[model samples]
Target: MIIKVRLIPTTGRNEVISRIGSVLRVKIKNKKVDDDAANAIMRTFLADFFNVHEESIIIVKGAKGKEKTVEVRDKSEEELRKIMDSIP
Candidate 1:
């Protein structure tokens, strides 16, 4: 499924908030909102947070901006919500 996210980079701490359906509000510390950094961070964060493979997370939009649309190809909505809720 696809998830729309508004990422807040360079925050004091990192977290994810899920208020809207299939959308995430994220804050990542010391991260740049660029192609390489965003892709790398998205991969790492998803893997670490969701216990999923890096390949499962894809950036469908906002690759160069803070607001992003991500594709989680291998996860169900309930599974994704569990991961989001698990974020610190």
Candidate 2:
């Protein structure tokens, strides 16, 4: 499944803030972290959230920007939707 994410950095914590339509708004702590570090953090958090390995998640676009397009392997859209729904 392909997921759109908007990352908000330096929020003092890593979490999924909200989801609007096909986009997920996420926040990550650390104002000094670079783009690569931020992306790695995002991948790790998402892997745990989706119950998948870190290698299964890839940032297909917007690697240098706040917005990113992620591709998730080994999961169906319906399954992802269910998992997303479980988030509070």
Candidate 3:
């Protein structure tokens, strides 16, 4: 499923709040907002949350910004939420 996420960098901790059904508000440490860091975080978040491979999570938008829209195919909203909630 595809989800819209408004990322807040420089946050105290990483978290995910569901907004509506397919949108999420994600907050992450600013130190992880850089290109390499973002990719690593994304991978870890998705893999741990959804129990999927890191390659499954795709950032469809905001690749260079704090806010992003991500596409994680073959997963339902419920599963996505569980995955997101698992993020630390």
Candidate 4:
């Protein structure tokens, strides 16, 4: 499924802030070295956070921007809900 995220880069730590309605607010701890660096950090960090391969996380939009649209292949909304519900 596709989801939207508001990425806050160069934060003190990498974290998933909260679920603000439809958007997932995230913060990257790594310093903003460059646009590619920022995007790489996001991909790897999110991959670990969501327990998926880094290759599976596709930054469909806003690669160099703060607001990003990510696509996770094959997963459905219900599946995502189940996973999030399991996280505490």
Candidate 5:
């Protein structure tokens, strides 16, 4: 599923913040990088969180900004959606 997740890059401890309404707010774990700040980390975190391969998640938009459109491959989309739907 293609979803927009707002990312917050902080100094300590990575965490998935609570979802409020249609927006999924996430605090990105801080990681110093040569390129984009922790985009890879975010992908990896989501992949592990959703129990999917890193290749299965794509940053469809906002690679350099806070709000990102993440594409979780079909192999996990249904599973992802169900889990997301269960969230308040």
Candidate 6:
């Protein structure tokens, strides 16, 4: 499934904050990290969150910006929503 995400980096912890329409708001915990590192962190977090392999997550766009377009392999939109809804 392809999803839109707004990544907030250098936060307290990696988490899915909320979903607003088509966009998923997420936060990453690594402070002082570069853009590449932040993207890696986002991929890893999403992989674990969606119970998919790290290679299954891809940043399709906005690699250097807060807003990103991601491709998640082997998951449907409905399944993704279920996982997102379970986030605290």
* Model 2 alpha-carbon drift over 4 Å, by segment: 32-34
Write the residue-wise lDDT of candidate 6 on 1-88 in tens digits: 8889888765588888888876888888866333888889999998998899999999898888889999999888899878766655
TM-score against native, each model: 0.72, 0.88, 0.65, 0.80, 0.80, 0.84
* lDDT value, candidate 6, whole model: 0.84
- What is the C-alpha lDDT profile of model 1 across 2-60, one tens digit per residue? 77777767667665654465567776764576567766776677666666788888888
- Report how far residue 54 has shifted in candidate 3, in Å: 1.3
Off by over 4 Å in 4: 74-76, 85-88
Prediction-by-prediction clash tally? 0, 0, 1, 0, 0, 0
Score residue 84 of candidate 6 by CA lDDT: 66
Q: Could you give me the TM-score of model 4 versus the true structure?
A: 0.80
Write down the worst ten-residue block by lDDT for model 2: 26-35
**Residue pairs of candidate 5 with colliding backbone atoms:** none
- Candidate 5 C-alpha lDDT tens digits along 1-88: 8877777767776667778765677666674422275788888888877778999889888887777788888465567778777655
Query: Which segments of candidate 3 are over 4 A away from where they belong?
Result: 18-21, 32-34, 74-88
True-structure Cα RMSD, model 5: 2.7
User: Against the hidden true structure, what lDDT does model 4 obtain?
Assistant: 0.76
What is candidate 3's lDDT per residue for 10-87, written digit by digit as tens?
Answer: 557666645545556666666656476875676577555566777778888888766677778666778776765654
Q: Could you tell me how far off, in angstroms, the CA of residue 68 lies in candidate 1 after the best superposition?
A: 0.8
Q: Each candidate: what lDDT?
A: 0.71, 0.85, 0.67, 0.76, 0.74, 0.84
Candidate 5 whole-model C-alpha lDDT, 0 to 1: 0.74
TM-score of 6: 0.84
Q: How well does candidate 2 score on lDDT at residue 36?
A: 87
Compared with the true structure, what per-residue lDDT tens digits does model 2 show for residues 1-88? 9999988876577888888887888888846333888889999998988989999999999988889999988888899989777655
Clashes of 5: 0
RMSD of each: 2.8, 1.8, 3.8, 2.6, 2.7, 2.2
Cα-lDDT of candidate 3: 0.67
